[model samples]
Target: MASTEAPEVLRYAAFTGDPAGGNPAGVVLDATGLDASRMLALAAEVGYSETAFITGRDEARRRFSVRYFSPLAEVAFCGHATLATSVALAERIGTGALLFDTPAGEIGVDTVTGPDGKVRATLTSVPTRSRPAEAIEVDATLAALRWAAADLDPDLPPHVSFAGNDHLVLAAASRARLADLAYDFDALTAVMRTHGWTTVHLVWRESEGSYHARDPFPVGGVVEDPATGAAAAAFGGYLRTLGLVTAPRTVAVRQGEDMGRPSDLTVEVDPYETRVRVTGQAVPIP
Candidate 1:
């Protein structure tokens, strides 16, 4: 990567085994000499929600320094891109444990090949955290989304959650409410920039351990994210913190179905651990 040669960017769709069913991300396995400006330019060219770059590596420790960039700017962390990068690495280096030093924190990734010959990656996120969203902030967000307060789920409440990056979590009162997602992009972008929010994690609880989600990522210069592992990680903490779900639970998230690219993610929360684990399969996009 240090060389001046053009970097080889690989494309992969994360959270689904099918190439067309998940979030697409660009992976630059070797990005040694690429500067921030070049990386950002490359990310914009790749044009996914985000692209992952491998800037440094340690062979003995199976560790690498990684950075994620959205089409607009650099991001603190990106779960789908992390999964894509891990699988891209595993394809060449063989599946096993890999550690990534990210701007947010150290992320632990484990990759294994399933019986169906698909590579599945599980990422362990940084410590999760959350706080109640201010009333004004909620009101502004609701206004931007064109949703009423009645559309909010009483049980979930409004909170800003963090698992590397900050996200505004809003639960829908019903599935229909979640499905109707026409919003003022510029207004929501303004609100997110003001609050340092990465995405608006709009969701609906389908059952005790299952949910559907849609993430508005205007901050990332994207209309929506097909699958959002970082938000799912933060949500696990939100659920645990609110006593909505008991610890040692696994939550199934179904995203992108409404967008035509269905994605599935499994989030695991441990009783004693603060970090959340998100697992999904990634496939090369031809």
Candidate 2:
């Protein structure tokens, strides 16, 4: 049974220090009495790309049980929501390390105030994996996106990457190609449902360590995500796996610029483990 009282919800934007930027997420720090149906209803009402509900907590271990939901359905994990929740927790309690028991796995997060006095959170994701997109899937996706093969970057091939949630990675040849994002929403949504993809990660590599990204999250009932931490983690894993970037390297991801809300994400990778680390600052949205 769920409580009749309305749960207190907090709104925060992740991957940026400015409230006007980044991806906004609804966070319910004390969702003890909420059931799955109630959680889903609250998430849909909030109208964010993703919302996080913390059901159980372990004070001794600083651990929490978290569930993620989009406007439409529940998801395995959501990185932006995790960052938002961590920042929310850090603001209330002292900032340090925290553990989250998500459906994907146990994720470790660290929060601290930077030299600029902004709260930043770093999340270590679960093990990640990637697989090349099949020809049929790619063809259908391309048709839905109205993108031609010539617009694709030759260096970065198409792959479906997973870091908690799955994303279809498509590297455009130029910044212009990436910026012009007018896709068939229903068509892409159908394809995403069929493949169980959270978002379509459209990116353009600017330099060896710098890249620009845009995410289409039709399944989440959102046209685009301002900042996508999950896709960023999966991208780091994909780069290391494909040897596009070496281990122990840091990649800078610039996103949401085209949408008027600019956000930045830092991705770190190592050769020793499959888990990718994503770091960014989050700000409360008043």
lDDT of each: 0.94, 0.93
Write down the TM-score of every candidate: 0.98, 0.98
Which ten contiguous residues of candidate 1 have the minimum total lDDT? Answer: 238-247
In order of listing, the candidates' clash counts read 0, 0
Candidate 2: minimum summed lDDT over ten consecutive residues — where? Answer: 238-247
How would you encode candidate 2's per-residue C-alpha lDDT over 191-249 as one tens digit per residue?
99999899999999999999999999999899999999999999988887787765488
* Residue 79 in candidate 2, Cα distance off native in Å: 0.5
User: Of the candidates shown, which would achieve the greatest lDDT relative to the real structure?
Assistant: 1
Off by over 4 Å in 1: 1-4
Give residue 163's error in model 2 in angstroms.
0.4
Summarize candidate 1's per-residue lDDT along 44-156 as a digit string, tens digits: 99999999999999967889999999999999999999999999999998999999999999999999999999899999999998899999999999999999999999989
Give the distance in Å from residue 49's predicted Cα in candidate 1 to where it truly belongs.
0.6
lDDT of 2 at 32: 95
